[model samples]
Each structure stands twice: as structure tokens, then as C-alpha cells.
Target chain A: MKGFLLQGKNLSRLRGRLKSALLVRIAVYLLLVDLAFVFAYPFLYMMVTSLKSPQDVRDITVNWLPSGLHWNNYRLSFSLLGYPSALARTVLVVGGCTLGHLFSCSFVGYGFARFSFRGKSLFFLLLLLSIIVPVQTIIVPEYIFFSGAGFLGTYLPMMVPSWLGFGLSGGLFIFIFRLFYISLPRSLEEAAGIDGCGAVSTFFRIALPASRSSVMVCLVLSLVWHWNDYFEPLIYITQQKKYLLPMLLPGLYRIMGGMQDASLSGGDALGDIYTEAVAMAATFLVVLPLLIAYLFLQKKFVQGVERSGITGE
Target chain B: MKLSYSQKRRWSGYVFLLPWLVGAAFFLVYPFVFSIALSVSDLENNNFTKMFFVGLANYKKAFVTDVEFVPKFLTVVTDTLINTPMIVIFAFLTAIMVSRDIKGKGIFRALFFLPVLLGTGFVMQQLQGQSIQSGSLEVARGILLPEKLQAYLGYEITGYITAFFNRITIVMWGSGVQIVIMLAGIQSIAPALYEVARVDGATEWEMFWKITLPMSAPILLLCIVYTIAASFTGSSQVVDYIISLAFGTAVPQFAYSAAMGWIYFLFVLAVILLVFLMMRRPVNRVAQR
Candidate 1:
């Protein structure tokens, strides 16, 4: 009878522990879902709205689900955006800038990381200033300089600065690379030096390859930034044929005309409702490449963020 | 004839820094000085050829004469002040959530980081336009707050709550990078530390407050600075206003725009400096601890 009582108490205690554990798990999952929804809501909304027909969008009862799939909207948006050419140009600009950043930033970062130089701290301060100062502050002079150099219609204004390690958030990349390199063990570089490898050679052959995570971080980030950069491209690329992907957005409405008429006519207009679907479709197309790339590369990206020593030791 | 080791190192360092040195001299230093010159000069027909010295007239106009600049600038300032904390806190929480040992952790991280890819520039602008331009506010409020709760909270309270919800939508979207950084910071806290805390009878909450929060203070400051920079530079009312003043006006007020830009830049610098100053003691304490 004593043994039975003891077993009963043990079982009850076990059940109590399990119950709380279950509650905690439930709570954690709830919080996760709650936060995730906030980030996911707009994308999901865009996706669903993109798939909705004009009539379905305006129907009072229709909320989440559409009556039928509207592939035509995607078709319309694709043609309107001239997806192929825009994608090609975006790839060119984003690719060049990313490459420029990868090489130039890592090089400069290596300098700051591995060696002490005169004015090093002062230079670092300037790097921080570059990160903080709005490009708008200096864009006027930059515009004048570029226009005078007859480089306004070209990608040089964007790509050249990036190549020299002062492009969009280039300082941050340099900072990241510097941190990662600082944390690296010195014995390898020392051994390489002992074997008569020059500093530049050692950096190129050993240090650069070793900091793969930082490179990945720089690559992914620079790509995203350059891809999403609208203002710079807008200011420089005046030729319609030269417009990048983001530049396509502001003009999407006018290019895909007939929708504005319904928008102008107050409410309950078919054109008004369908325009959203098409616009959502266009937006989705614009982000589609990066979104897919992220889905595949997210693990690497997250790992890159962690291992890049961005949260510095 | 061989160079000393330190001398060799310095020479190599200069070589590596060559790109930045060249780039900065042309792109950074020149533009900086030129912008200052532009801001202080009066230009005819917005051309440099017709420019002359104007001293602080443009700055004076921005402060004392321009009606639209101050209010818009103030709005940007207040928005940043309110938005930055909420973003940082939300990101911290989301980072904690993502850092947990859970199933499909990759999916959660990807979902959370989606905004970093899409939140800025054109995609965000388009989505925001669609929602605001359409009747989505009504739908959003309807979904966010039920009728019973709205009635219970009263009209004014509900209005405030809905407004908060709207703000939170933007906040959540802006937190992608912060979440990633915080996750990294939290992950860097050694598991051994947590184990030790657990052995010492610390609950999760206690462990977080006593250990994680204190340790991650530096990273948190970095996030705050980053958030401020991102908020100011990202597409916003102030940026739009500044750009319009520069280019959108019939006679591009070149000097006036540069002055306003300088004014805005100073405000941003001040805020960033303020953040650093405010967080210094706590961060130093963390370092000491």
C-alpha cells in the first residue's frame, strides 16, 4: 500500500511536469506564430491578391480566397514590366556592385584588420561617418561631378565608387570583414610569412579564402542593397532602355495604363480592384528572384550572419 | 637593403588601402567639401557657373524662413524616436524566439528575415501604396480588433490601439536586420554560461535578464545606431522632402536643398551621438562585468 501510494505520487508529479512542459511549448509556438505572421502577412497578401481576379477582389464576401486563379494578371504584369530586359539590367548592376564590394571592401578590411597604420583610428571614424551620413547630403556635388565627367548615363557613378570601397554601406562591409579577420588566429598568417609569403600574397592566398563567411555576408547584402537601390539609378539612368528593376515600379502604373481611370472614379470600380492584382503581380515579380534565392540561401545567410563576427566578440 | 618587418607591414597596409584612399579623395572628401561650398553659395539657374557666396543665408532660410522644413523635420525626428525602440524590442523578442531550439528553425529565420530583402525601396513603397490607397485600413482594423473589444476599450482607446497596430506593421517590417544581428549576439553567449545559470537555480526569465541582456548590450547599441541610420536614409517623408527641394521644384533650390540636407544630416548625427552617449555607461558596465 505504501509502494502504491509512492507510485501514484510519482506518476502525478510526472504528469504535472509534462503538463507544464506542454503549456510552455504551446506558448512558445504561439509567440512564434504571432511574430512570424507580422512579417509574412504582406507577402502572403500580395501573393493572394496577385492571384485574384477583378470581380473576386471587389466581391464583399471574398476575403482571402479568390473565386478563380488569375494567371492573366501575371501575364499582363510580365509583359508590362518587360521582365527579361529589366532582369538582365538589374543583374548587371547588382552583379558589378557586389563584385566591386567583395573585392574592394575585403581588401581594405584586411588592411585595417591585420596591420596598424598611421591615422588608422581616424580612418575608422571616417568609415563610421560614411555609414551614418545620408547620401543625399553629398549627392548634389556627386551629380554635378558625374554630369561634368559625362558619366551620368552610365553605371560608373554607382559601380566605380563601390569598386573603391565607398559605395552603399561599403563601410559596414569593411567593418564586418575587419571584425572577422581580427578574430582569426594569427599562427597561419605568421607561418605563411615565415615561408616568405609577402603580406599581399598571404592575404590573397590565405586570409581572403579563410574569411568565407564574411564574403558571403557581403555578397548577399550588397546584392540586396544594389538590387533594391532606386534613387541612385533613378538619378543616373535617365534612358528608359537603361532602367533597372526598381525604376520600373514608379512607372508601372502609367506604362500599364487604363487602370488609373477606375482609380479616379471613386469606389466599386472594376478597374480599381483589378489594378491592385496587377500591381501586386508586378511587385511580386520584382522580388521573385531575390525571394527564391533567399529561400535557398537562407541557411547560409543566417550562418554567415552568425559566423561573420558581426556581433563582435 | 631589406626593409624592417614593421615597415614592410605598413607599406603592405597602404597598398591594401589604396582603393579606399583613392575613392575617398575623389568621391568622399571632394563631395563633402563641395557640398559644404554648395550649401553656402547662391547659384543662378541652379548652375555652379553662376554661383556666388551666400554665407549662412540658406541655413537661415531653412530655420527662420522656410515653413515646411521644420515641421517635416520634427515629424521625422519624433517618428525615429518612437519607432527605433519599438523596432529594437520587437527584434530582440523575435531573435529570442528564433534562437530557441525548435523544429523548422530555418523556416522561421527565413520568414523573419524576409523583410530585410523586401522592406526597402520600391517593393515596400508599392505595397504600402496599395494598402493606404485602397480600403485596407478598414479591413485591417476589422481583423485586428473585434467589435466587442473595441466597444469595451472605448472609441478613443481603440483609435489609439489601431494606430499602434498600424505603426507596428511598419516596425515589424523594419526589424529584419536587427533580428538577425540580435540572434547572432544571443547565439554567441556561451551555452556553458546558460548551463551554469541553470545549475544555480535561475529560471529562463532570470537567466535572460541577468545574463543575456547584460552581455548583449553592445550588440544592442549597434542595432540602435543601425536602426537610426536606416530609418533616416530609407525612403521617408523627410528624404522625399529633401529630394523635392533639390530637384522637384521648378527652380531647383540647389543651395537651399544643400542647406536643408546639411541641417537634416546634423540632426541625424546629433541623434546618433545622443544614442552613443546614453548607452555608454551601461555598455561600459557590461564590459566591466
Candidate 2:
């Protein structure tokens, strides 16, 4: 009878433990869902609004959904954005810059990771400084230099610095590569060294091959930054004909006649024709390629960042 | 004539770094010094050849004469102060959540990181609807909460909600990279440490405070620095004003723009250095352990 009473007490304790664990799990899930909604609401709003017809957009009752699918918004924006050319140019610049970062950043990173030399600490400090200083601070002089060099209005100004590992957030890329390379075991490289493989060939053959995940992280980041950035392109490519995708956005706003206050414009016929829906559609189309690429690369991208060992030793 | 092994290694390191070194001289150092020179010299009609030394007049204008400059600069400073801590804390918390052995961890990570993909560029600005003038605060009011709810919630409560959502929007959008860095830091911590703590009769809360936080101190510092840099450099009123000064106006005030940029850069650098100095010793202590 005493043993039976002890077993009952143990069972109740276990049950109580399980109950609190369940409650904690439910609470965690609730918090996660709420945060997720906040993160995702902007995208949802954009998508829904992009599909709304003019009448539906005007209707006060319509908030989340449109009365019907409006394909015309997409159609109009697609044609008006000069989608094909702008997209091609964007791909070209982003691709070139990505390739540039992959080549130069890794090479520089490998050097820092594998070799020790004089002023190494000082160089690293400068690298940190490079990352900290805003590009705008030095852009005026760089612009003047590029203009004097006759590189303005061409893609060279954008692509050359990246190729040399000094482009947009280039120092950070090198730092990422350095951290990743430092984390890797030296046995393979040492073995290759003993085998007379030479440093360059060893890097090309073994080190670079093993650092694929770091490469992936850099590639995604570089591509997205270059794709989204309008500032440098705006400064360098002054000609309207050579405008990159992001540069075209502001111009699109101007053409939509939507830059002025809508109420003051009094909802003119052109404003109605080009409406907020069309603008959202253009924005959607602009981001569609990156979004699709991200969806496919999501798993690898997250894993790659985790494996990059960005938290230094 | 043969070189020592250490000498060869040093030479090769320089060889690999040659491109970057040259690039830095031109891209970083020259531009850095040249901008300093430009700040003190007035240029007319984009003609550097016709430039004249203005003797600190541009800096004086920014500080003393230009009414728009000081107020806008202060706004940016205050905004950075408010936003940086929020981004860092929110990111660390979210990183902890997603790093847990939860189901759909990948999806949660992706959603959390969506801002890194879409937040910076034209799409976000366009979506925020006033395009040029609308800040994140305007964005929250315009879209996040419905018009009816704002009316129902009344002016004061709605103002509070709008402000809350404004901060949330900014923090969530900016914290993506920080979250990734923090996650990496947490995951890199040894499981053995946690096991030992548990064996010592420590609770989950204790383990987090004693093990997770201290071990990730270096990364926490990094995330703080990165978020601070992003806040300063990424789209802000000061940056926009500088851009307009240099390019947007009919007669571009290149020297004035350079002066203003330098002021902003110095302020940002000062803040970062102060933070680094404050955090350095603690981070090193944890690292030594």
C-alpha cells in the first residue's frame, strides 16, 4: 500500500513536468508565429496590393484581398519598366560584381588566413576601418577620379574595384573568407606542401574547392547587394540609356506621375491609369528574380552562413 | 641568392595581397586624402582646375550657417542611438529562437532573413509608398495597421501602436545579418559546456546566461558594430542631404558635400571606437576562458 502511494506521487510529478514542458512549447510557438507575421506582413501586403484592380484599390472595404485578379497591372508594368533591357543590364552588372568578389576576395582572404607577415595586425585594423567607413565619405573624390579617367558612363567603374577586392562591402567579404579559411584544418594544405603542390595550385585544387560554402555565401550576398544598389550606378552611369534596374525605379515613379501628392493631384485619369497597383506590380517584377533564386538557394544559404564561422576564434 | 622559407612565405603573402594593396592606395587612401582636400576647396562648374581654397568655410557652413544640416545630423544621431540596441537585442533573441531544435527551423530562418534580400533597395522604398520622403514610421502607419483599427484604437493608443510597429519594422528589417552572425556564434559553442552545466544542476536559464551569453560575447560585439554601421551608412536624412548637395542641385556644392560627409563619418567612427573600447576587455576575458 505504501509502495503504491509512492508510485502515484511519482506519476503525478512526471505528469506535472510534462504539462509545463507542453505549456512552454506552446508559448514559444506563439511568439515565433507572431514575430514571423511581422516579418512577413510587408511582403504579403505588397503581393495583395499588386493584384488589386483600380476600383478594388479605391474601395475602403477591400483591405487584404481584391475583388478579382488584375493581370493588367503586371502587364502594364512589365511593358512600361522596359523589363527586358533593365533586367539584362542588372544581371550583367550583378553577375560581374559577384564573380569579381568571388575571385579577388577569396584570394586576398586566403593570403591573410594562411600567411603571417609584417604589419599584419595593422593591415587587419585598416580592413576593419574600411568596413566601418561609409562609402559616401570617399565617393566624391572617387567620382572625380573615375570621371577624369573617362570610366564614367561605363560599367568599368563598378566592376574594376570589385575585381580588386575593394567594392561594396568588399573588406567584409575578405574578412568572411579569412574566418572560414582559418577554421579549416591545415593538414590537407600541409600534405600538399610536402608533395610539392605549391601554394597557388594547392589553393585552386584543394582549398578553394573545400571552401565552396563560403563561396556560396559571398555569391548570394554580392549578387543581392549589386542588384539592389542604385547609388554607385547612379553616380557612374549618368546616361539614361545605361541605367541599371534600381536606377530605373525612381524614373518609373516620375513617369507614373505619382511622385507628387496624390490628393493634390486630385486623382487625375493618368494617375488612375498608372495607380498604386501598377507601381506595386513593377516593384514585384523588379524583385521577382532575386526572390525565386533565394527560394531555391534558401537551405544552402542558411547552412553556408552557419558554416562560415564568422564568429572569430 | 636563395631566400629563407619565412621570406618566401612573406613574399607570397604580399603577392596575393598585391591587387588589394594597389586598389586600396587608389580606391581607399587616395580618395580619403583627396576628399579631405576637396572639403577645404570650392569647385565651380565641376572644374577642379578652377578650384579655390575655402579655408574651413564648408565645415563652418555645416555647423554654424546651414540650418538644415545640424538638425538633420542630430536626428540621425538620435535615431541611431534608439535603433542600434533594439536591432541587436531583437536579433539575438530571434537567433536563439530559430537556433532551438524546433520544427520548421529553416523556414523560420528564411522568413527572418527576408529583409536582407528586399529591405535595402528600391523595392522597399517603393513599397513604403511616399518613395522619397517616407521614413519607416510613415511606412507602419500607411500599411501595417488598417485605417479602421487606428480610428478604433484612438489617437493616443494608435500613436503608441504606430510607434511600436515603426520600431518593429526597422528592427526586423535591419537585424537579418545580425541574427545570422549570432546564430553562428551560438551554434559554435560546444555542447559539452551545456552538458556539464546541466550535470551541475543548472537550469536552462542559468546555462544561457552563464554559457551562451559569455561565449558569444565577441560575436555580440561584432553584431553591435555592424548594426551601428548600417544605421549610419544606409539610407538616412543626412546621407540624402549629402547626395542632394553633391548632385541633385543645379549648381552642385561638391566641397560642401565632402565636408558634411566627413563630419558624419567622424561622428560614426567616434561612436564605433567608443563601443569597441568599452566591449573589448570583456570580450577578451571571455575568449581567454
The best candidate in terms of DockQ:
1
Kindly list the per-residue Cα lDDT of model 2 for residues B1-289, writing each as its tens digit.
9988789889888878887888888898998898898999988877878888989999999999999999999999998999899998899988998899989888888998787777788656555444225434545765678988878888888777776787677678778888888988899888999999989989778988998888888999989898899889998899999998888999888889999999999999999999999999879987687
The worst-scoring run of ten residues by lDDT in candidate 2 chain A lies at A256-265
Full-model lDDT for every candidate? 0.84, 0.84
Off by over 4 Å in 1: A1-19, A254-260, A263-274, B130-140, B151-154, B285-289
Candidate DockQ values, in order, are 0.74, 0.69
Off by over 4 Å in 2: A1-13, A257-268, B44-46, B127-154
| Candidate 1 chain A lDDT trough over 10 residues, lowest sum | A255-264
Question: Candidate 1, residues B1-289: lDDT per residue as tens digits?
Answer: 8999999998898899999989888788898899899899999877688889989999999889989888988888899999999999999988987798888778888888887787776656655665566524433577779989989989888877877787788788889889998999899887999999889878788998988898898899999999999999877787888888886778788888888889989989999999999999878987675
Candidate 2, residue B63: Cα displacement in angstroms equals 0.9
Inter-residue clash pairs, candidate 1? none
Span of 10 residues, lowest total lDDT, candidate 2 chain B: B128-137
Put down candidate 2 lDDT per residue, A187-229, tens digits, no spaces.
9999998898877888889999998878888888888888888
